[model samples]
Target: MARQLRERAEQHTETHLTLRDLRHVCWDPVPGAVVYVCENPRVVEAAADAGMDAGLVCTSGNATTVVHTLLTALVEGGTRLYVRGDFDWAGVAMVERLLTRYPAQPWRMSAADYEQQVERARDRRTPLQPLEGRPQTASWDPELAPSMNSFGMAVHEESALDLLVQDLRQRP
Candidate 1:
């Protein structure tokens, strides 16, 4: 299944795998493998559109059981996960959950990344939606939550597609 996903990725195609598909599949550990995981499908779409031959996964919001199953298999296979999501409170919470539950790293989801995206929006005269809901702390990066609080703006994943795509391009 992982090899099939890789083939689809090589062809720049989007492949969705379900829990049933993963139930009987055996995953061989891929040493030094890197996969980009995000909350939105747009990042995957953008990477595919750019013809990037990188392993990309999207949760399409809060991860479901299938997502967790896939991630667990990936982690067991020694794949390094780089995770990113919207800059809103819920997004932060989702990221925090993944970071804690899995061996994953933040991908362009630092205080600097949030600030950069906020600045870019300001520069383009684009008004970002004010953040709603209770604020969530970013345990992976201590300063990220404070920075987002300071701005009180939500930076959706769409706004950071360029940087995300660039990161995908630079994947080893």
Candidate 2:
């Protein structure tokens, strides 16, 4: 399923816009529309398999030119963007980027959400290193980055997939 979504996302990129050209386009979701964002291919695949009734796009780990282009277009189109990613540093970074680049709503990517998931973690002893690139503030939720830093561990979005899907289903 992941592969299929990846392929689709890639194909979408081939015909649409490359990541480099993202800055030139605008990606705004329609009012009340939901656009799912993720760092992993599997999540994209699952969403695709479930039938993406809403606007959906995959970042495929880090915002590539294609991901940026699609997201920008959605924002310009006035579509509401919902982003979810690994709970780790990279995830936070990705969320930060999305929030900064696009007017996106937080999709369970919060400190409270992280705390709940942390309580459910199987192994909590291993401390995660801070994400290396330029750290960007999470404009939507300021406390998120700090909370992750305090916890010193990474959380993958897959861990919270059920919560995200349930939330998406409830949205009209």
- Among these predictions, the greatest TM-score belongs to 1
Q: How far off is model 1, as Cα RMSD?
A: 1.5
Tens digits of per-residue lDDT, candidate 1, 1-172, equal: 7678667767899988888889867677887799889999998899989988888889999999999999998898899998888999999999999999998998988999999999998997877999899988899888998999999999999987888899888986
lDDT of 2 by residue, 44-134 (tens): 5555455544445667789876777676666667677888788776677777777777777767877898877776564544344444543
Q: Runs in model 1 with CA error above 4 Å?
A: 1-6
Clashes of each: 0, 24
Question: What would you estimate as the lDDT of candidate 2?
Answer: 0.65
Off by over 4 Å in 2: 1-32, 49-52, 123-137
Local distance difference test scores for all models:
0.90, 0.65
RMSD in order of candidates: 1.5, 6.2
